[model samples]
Target chain A: MKRLTLALMVLMLSACVSVEYVTPYDPVIDNGIREYKESINTLAKNLGDQAGTEAGTYEANLAHYNALESKIDLLIERANLQSAGRGCRLAEGISAQLAKVAPEPMIQTEEGDSYGCTERLLVLVKDQLDLLQNIHQSADKCNAMASPRGTKISCLRATTSKAAMKITNQSINAVWVVETAKKNGDNG
Target chain B: MSVNFEQVLANILDSAASAFGDGWDSIKTYAPAEFKKISSQIVEIAENVAKYQLNDNEGYSAQTGKLLLQMQRNATEGVLVAVSTLTLIAVQNAINAIFASLRETFNDALGAIL
Candidate 1:
């Protein structure tokens, strides 16, 4: 009887020690992710429209679009993980996306002959910034409903999203100035 | 004379930042404690706007100015909601007045060069 009681206690302890993983479901986040993907696709289409037929510019713009698409894919993967309660991974993915999308300085040409592609690119960047802000706001709402780990990830997402918007805003401003100067010189 | 776009942009940004700071100071004093925590965030938003280098193009300048006004309104609403004492609509008139004054100030400063 003593041995049987000890065995029953061990079984109870084992049951208590076992952990079960449960995926979290948030409709708002799911909708936001879907919207985000749609927006990226729209921007990609816009970029393609603005990409001129010139071989070099076409190739360059195509590469940039490809990079953006790949980042979107990664973000979707991270969102899937986030749905599974993998918050840290989502945060890392967001940070990585921000770093990847951060704009580089535009190459200045003496003739300033970009065929208006630069202006279109700046518009695309601005749209992306707006989307990041939307994502950040959605994540903030999710943070309130999420577990501690999810909150940490959401916090990271919110912070990185703002940072990305700021960086992209600066890029847009710089490009606008450059484009304006070129136009002014041409007009004069 | 060649217009120095950078100088004009810097002046505009500086003026806007100063005006925003003053407006924020007033709001902070009147706002409840919970709203005060967002002071830094407001400043950061102002700084982000100040970082932009705008052109003298009337259309572009107008668009940017409008966007800035919208941002100011959004920030005001955010602050008002933080207090939880007043609905956004109740304070909408007051906030709109403040933003109008700020916009006027920005326009006056920008109009001289832009």
Candidate 2:
């Protein structure tokens, strides 16, 4: 009888500790991230190639930039739409874990809600897009001016384009890694 | 037949430690690597900003004045959040392992006792 009670106690304690580690895998997020990365890369490369030309001006590429923004916005919304209760549970689990490991202050999400890690990842990607746009717009403004050689200067230099793309890709890859972990059943 | 509470407790602890050890590798590998990448990218952004300033014939270029600084901050936050997520996943795996082992051992002990 004593052994039975102890065993039951252990079982109860174990049940109390069980938790869902990650949000369920969503194909939409995986596919969306992949698509965004590819499209952003292509756009950055094209812009770099056409730097200082009429084709590369911010005005000319405004539609493409806007489309990309819209795409990312949709992705962010989808992340928020992830079954809220479940995502919130994962968010709470992550928060408890973060308090244990990270000494740095937590990053604030755009909504400041319990939407979980995936939503924050999307928000970060959106930030990268904004940075890219700022760079492109500034370069366009600079390109409107001519140098001593009577040729327009390409402020959006190849190096600048490459740097922007590199930073953006890093954030994008982070999102994919977490999502893949979920898909692999690492959510235990 | 009897259930050994001490043995079960040891097994549960062992399971947790082993799972955490394995999952910790992911955090160690990912966090440092990503920190390195993010640091380099930040340096690259600064370098690009400096180059832009040097090449500006006009005294009016404000490329990095406000925009790039924010970008740098965002980049840092992004990487840190990724590290945090990785850490959470590791902890989750560890807890799950502990519970799994407990369930197994408890079941076996109950079967033997009955």
Candidate 3:
């Protein structure tokens, strides 16, 4: 009878063990991230092929950059809108820990804690897009200065483009992993 | 009706073990693989930057290489964050499953109180 009482107590307490460890999976966010990744990869390839050409100039590609940036901003907003309380505590904790161990601090948006993990990941993607733009613009500037001397210039070096592509894919995979885990559970 | 402590204990243990078993499998397979992938990416960035610096026309300035390295660091952080999230979700599911498995037993013991 004592053991029965103890078991009843345990079962009753376990009944209230609910907690929200992370946000629920959103199909829209998952699909948006995958599509955005494809777009970036395509852009990287185009930039690589036209590196030394007029088409590769940052000015020529400004519209494409703007469009991608806008898209990412929209994705971020969607992620923000879905912010459940205590959103992705694990992600928040990991980011905090990594900030300490990283050689430099992790990049964070100006709003910081106002956004959740998904929004944060999208922000990182936006930063990468901006970095790519800087790389392209730098090459264009170099070309502008060297044109009078008849020197050849590459707007986006192939090596740099490849590295950019790899890192971008890595970033996107991070978000993909999280979303997959949420959707597929153990199989994820 | 009185509860059978032995059977309840066994059922709870079996339920908890099954739930956690799957979660452990995910940790074993996913975490290390992702860490390895991210590490390789970081190494490749350094290698490519070195080669880019050696090229005459396609050379990237030290600053640009530094920028890429910084981005690599961000990617690594992102991967770590995602993995942590994955682990948490697994644990959450496991806990929920354990509690759920007790539902029927609790209902039987407490006359539908659960």
Candidate 4:
């Protein structure tokens, strides 16, 4: 009886018993997902200023990216709900998409809208970001499935090179609008 | 999804009562009503959110969203304020119960001695 009592005491103290409904916060996953959403939005907003031309495409891209960011937030919330279990698949997809875009440097265009350039540069950035988000989302899923933290870190790193390649491959155009925005102080 | 949140709430109180060990049961009764109020508030906010979904870029609807967001913030800030304060009363009640139990056990021992 003493041993059983002592064992029960330990279980309750640790909160490790088979208690039907206990929600434990997993800080790493929670904070990391939030950080991903914030950074992706920052990246999207920053993308507009860096566009090759002042066409509608840049603004459209910004809207698309914002939508994506919102979706990521929802996915992360779902993941949190199942933090101790299998976790949400949507969370994994978003992370994967983010990893792809992390290293891809913003590409500028030499010709502005005056040169008849449609300026699809922002779209490229969005696609790249989406790729990274996908990978990161998958990583979140893997982490949820009894994954050790050590393995999860390694998984995030595995996609680093793909991101680096796209970013490094870019030939930055002199017509980068982001610098101009900063100079002129056009936040909106 | 009318999950009898009350039952879930009741269970929590039951476990809490067991932990308290005394006249705490009397005081513990107060918690269900408190939880019920919280549940109602949460439901109201949820209903309000559903009634007027906030815009994406705009966050919440400026008119409705702002009110709801402020309400949400206030609720978040205020949620534990009541529960935690009441918890002290619970602890006091629990202490009183344990003391009473201890007194009875000791009285039984004294009676045997007599």
- Report lDDT (CA) for all predictions: 0.35, 0.65, 0.66, 0.33
Q: Write the per-residue lDDT of candidate 4 for residues A15-117, one digit (tens) a residue.
A: 4322111122234334443454456545534432332222213233456546755654453444334433221121122223323333431222232111111
Tell how far residue A34 is off in model 1, in angstroms.
29
- Top TM-score prediction, candidate number: 3
* Alpha-carbon RMSD to native, per candidate: 27.7, 12.2, 12.5, 24.4
Question: What is the DockQ ranking, best to worst?
Answer: 3, 2, 4, 1
Kindly report the fnat of each predicted structure, to 2 decimals.
0.00, 0.38, 0.46, 0.00
RMSD (CA, Å), candidate 1 to true, equals 27.7
Worst 10 residues of 3 chain B by lDDT: B11-20
Error of 4 at A3 (Å): 13
| Clashing residue pairs, backbone N/CA/C < 3 A, model 3 | none
Cα misplacement distance, residue A58 of candidate 4 (Å): 5.8
TM-score of chain A of each: 0.27, 0.71, 0.73, 0.25
lDDT of 3 by residue, A76-130 (tens): 8888777632233333444455655576556444444322676667767788888
RMSD of 3: 12.5
Q: How does the DockQ of candidate 2 come out?
A: 0.19
Q: Give TM-scores of the second chain, every candidate.
A: 0.27, 0.61, 0.62, 0.41
Which is better, 1 or 3, measured by DockQ?
3
Which candidate, 1 or 4, has the higher lDDT? Answer: 1
TM-score of each: 0.21, 0.71, 0.73, 0.21
Q: Tens digits of per-residue lDDT for model 4 on B1-114? A: 333456645654554444334544444444455445434444443443344345322111224322332333222222222222233334444554555565556556544644
Candidate 1 segments exceeding 4 Å error: A1-113, A130-142, A145-158, A183-188, B1-114
Judged by DockQ, which candidate is best? 3
